[model samples]
Target: MAPPAWTTRPNAKDDLRERARELRRQHRSVPEVAAELGIAKSTAYRWVRDIPLDVDARKALFAREHSSTTGHGQMMAEARWSEYRAERDARQAERVTGAAGSVGGLTQEELVRIGAMMYWCEGAKAKPWNSTRRITFVNSDAGLILVFLAFLRAVGVEQSTIDFRVQIHETADADAAVRWWAAKVGADRTIFRRTSLKRHNPKTVRYNTGADYHGCLIVSVRRSRAIYDMVEGLVIGVVRAAGRPSAPCDPWPQ
Candidate 1:
C-alpha cells in the first residue's frame, strides 16, 4: 500500500509500514500500533486492513485484554464490598453501645418495677377457673433468672425457699444444664428437681443445639401464696394506672 503524502522517502515509508505490520502480527490494535510507530491511525489501518489475524491470535488478544479489565473490575467490587461491610459494622456497634450505656444508673425502685413487669409477662398467672396462684418463673436466659432471684432476695425470699428444675429437649445435656443453673442461682445441684425432657419430634428440625443450648430453668418459690398475691396486686395496680387518661393538651392557634 502507498504511504501518506507527508512521507516523501520511499525507503523510510516502507520501513514504517513493515514495523506497523509486525506490531499488528503481535495482536496490537491499528490505533495502538500507529501511536507507537509515530504514524496516523488511518495509514496503519490501510496498511494492515486486508491482513487477516489468525483465529488463535485474535482469541488470545481478546482473552488477555478481557482478563486485565475483569481483574480490575473484581478489585473495585471487592474494595466497595469491604468498605460497605466496615461502615455497616461501625454503625451497628455505635447503636448497640449507645443502647447498652443508656440503661446504666438504674435505681432499686426502677429495677423492682422492671422485675414486676417481667414477672407479669413470663411468670405463671392465676386463671379464673384454676385459682392456684404460684411464684413460678420459667426462662432460658441466665441473666433474667439472676435478676428475678435478686428481686426475690430483695423481697425477703430466702435461697432455701426457692426450688430449681431443668426443662429441656431429650437430645440436650440435662445434667450439665442442671449443674450450670445450680451454680448460677447459688444453689446445690442436689436440690434441683429431676430434669424434664420434652420428647423429640422426628418431623421437626430444631436449631437449639450446640454448647449455648442450656435448657429453660423453672424457678418455683416454695409456699409463695403471699408473694404471688403481692405480684398480682402490683400488676393490677400498674394496669389500672396505665388505663387512666392523661391531662388534656391545649388547643393550637388557628
Candidate 2:
C-alpha cells in the first residue's frame, strides 16, 4: 500500500523535520526554515520550537538581524553590498565628471585668489608674540605642492628663491624621498636643504610606511617678506567680504 498523504507531505517528512531542527539550533527563523525546507511556517515552528539556540547561534542571529549578514546570510549580504557600491560609484563618477567639465580653466586672477585661500589654510602665520614674517608651505600631497609652486612662480618668486626640505620618519627612505621631491619640483638637488628625520616611536602603529609614502616637502621662500603682506591682504579681503559693508583690514580693531 502507498504511504498516507500526511506522511508524504513535506511537513511530515522525517528528513526535512530533522533538517529544520538542526537549523533551529543555529537560530534560523521559522520563515527561513519553512522557505528552505518547502514546508509551512507553522509546521517549521512546531518541529523546532523547543530547540534552544546556543551562544554562537544567538550571536549569529543578532548579526543577521542587525546587518542582514552572518553565517548563512553572509554571501547574500555581500552580493547586496557589492551591487549597492557599484551603483553609488557610477552615480558619483557621473556627477563629478559633469562638474569637472564645467570648470574650464583657472585664470591668473583666479589662481591668485585660490593660492591665497590655500595659503591661508595651510601656510604658517605670524603672531604678535613671534612677529617673524616667513613664507613656509608644507604638504605631503604632491599635487598640492606642485600647485603651490606654480602659485609662487605666478607671484614672481624665482626657482632660485625657493628651498626644499624633506621631513620624514627615521624609518623611511630619506634619500629616495629627496630624489622624488627633487624630480617633482624640477629643482637641482643642491638647492635642497638637509632632511629632517623624526624619531620613530615603536609603540605607535603607523599606516604611512608604504612605498608610496614620500613624507612631507617643506617649501621655504627666501626673502619672502615682500609678498607676505600681499598674501595677508588677500586673505583679509576675503574674510572681510563675507557680507555687505567691508570692515577695515585691521585684524584686531578692538
Candidate 3:
C-alpha cells in the first residue's frame, strides 16, 4: 500500500523551529545554523526572532565564541609598529655616531676656515655696490666668533685700523643688538657710531623680532685687498674641507 502524500512531504516547520532554538541556545551564528540545517538564513533568523533573550545572555554568548579574535588582531598591529620603530631608531643612531666621528678628525686649520665661512655667509651683511669683502659680520655665535677674531689677530688688522664700527638694523631693539656684539668681541662701544634705526609700520609683514639679532660690526679697513683675499681663501678652504676638490679661483676675482 502507498504511503499518504502528507506523511511523505514531511512537515518541516516544527523541526526547523526546534533546530533554530537549539542553535540560539548553543551560541551558534544564524548563518552557521542555517547552513547545517539546509534552510535559508532569513528563515532561520525569523524562526528565532520571536524568542526573548536578555542583553547579558547575548553578550556572554558573543564573548565565548570570539574571545581570541581581538587579541590576535592587536598582536599583529603591535608587531608591525615594533618593526617600523626599530628601523627608525637604527637610522638615527647611525647619523649621530657618524657626526661624532667626523668632528674628532677636524684640524685646527679646518676649524679656522669653517669660522671664516660662517662669518662671511651667516654673520655678515652684504652691501649692493661692494662685494662680500666690504661686508661686515657680528660676533653672534660665540665659538665661531672667537675663532674668527683669532684668525683676524693672526692676520694683523690693528686696533687703530678697526675704525668706525656701527650697527644697521630695524628700530626695535637695535641698541640691544649693538651692545651684545660689542660685549662679545671685546670692542669699545664708544668706537661704535649710533645705531642706524629703520622705521617700522603696522602693515609690515616682517614678524621677525630680531631677538636672536646680533647686529653686524662695520670693520672698515685701510686696504680692502686683505679683506677680499681672506674671503676668497675661505671659500676654497671650505670646499676642500668637505672632500670636494674644487679648482681655487675667486668667484668675482677683480
Candidate 4:
C-alpha cells in the first residue's frame, strides 16, 4: 500500500529546506539558491532569510568571484597594451623613413665640418705636455674610416700619403682583419703595417670576436701638420659657434 500523502510531502519539503540552508552557508544569494533548488522564491527566502553570514565565509565567496573576474581583466589589459605598442612603433618607423628621405647628399663644407668633429673626438690631440702634430685617426668602425679617407681626398691628400695599421689581441685573426679593413677603406693591403698584438688574458672575456671582429684601425697621414692645423681651427670654430645665442648654420650644407 502507498504511504500517506502527508508523510511523503513533509519529507520532500524538509529535504528542500535543508538544501536551501546549505546554499545559504555557501554565501549564495536567496534568489540564486531558489533558482538552483527549483523552489518558489518565497519558500527559499523563508528557508534561508533568517541565517546570519560568517565573516570568513563571506570573504571566501568574494575571493572565488574575484579570481574569475581578475583573469578576464588581465587579458583585456594585455590586448590594449599590445595595440598601443603597435601604433607607437608604426609612428616611429614613419618618422625614420621621413628622415632618410631628407638626407639626399652631403655638401663638401658639411663633410669638412663632420670630418673635423670626428677627428677632434677620435683622432689624437696635441696637448701642451706632448706636442706631436699629425693627422692620425684611429677607430674600430669601418664607416668612420671611410669618411675620414673621403675627407682627406676632398682636401687633396694623395692615396700614397696615407698609411694603415691594425691593433688587436694576439688571440684574434689579424690577417683576416687587415683584409676586411683594406676592402672597407678601399686601400691597398700592402699599405698596412704589421698588426700590433696585445697579450690576451684568459680570465678576461671579450665581446668582440669571430668573423665580425675587425680590430681597431689606425690611419695616419704622412707630413700632415698643415692639415692637422686646419682641422684644429675648424673644431675651435664649431665649438665657438655652438656657444653663440644665434642658431648655428644648418649643419647640413645644401
lDDT of each: 0.85, 0.86, 0.65, 0.87
lDDT of 2: 0.86
Backbone clash tally for model 2?
0
- The best candidate by TM-score is 2
Model 3 C-alpha lDDT versus the unseen true structure = 0.65
lDDT by residue (125-166, candidate 4, tens digit) is 899998999999999998888898889988889888898999
| Quality of model 1 by C-alpha lDDT | 0.85
Note the clash tally of each candidate: 0, 0, 0, 0
Off by over 4 Å in 3: 1-108, 119-135, 138-144, 163-170, 210-216, 237-254
User: On residues 122-216, what C-alpha lDDT tens digit does candidate 3 reach at each position?
Assistant: 64445686455553455435566566666565556666665545454465676676677678778877777666565667677764465675555
**Stretches > 4 Å off in candidate 1:** 1-85, 243-254
| Candidate 4 Cα outliers beyond 4 Å, as residue runs | 1-97, 248-254
Instruction: Please rank every candidate by lDDT, starting with the best.
Output: 4, 2, 1, 3
Q: Which pairs clash in the backbone of model 4?
A: none
Cα TM-score per model: 0.63, 0.71, 0.44, 0.62
- Model 1: ten consecutive residues of lowest lDDT: 243-252
lDDT of 1 by residue, 100-136 (tens): 8998676777667677788989999889998987899
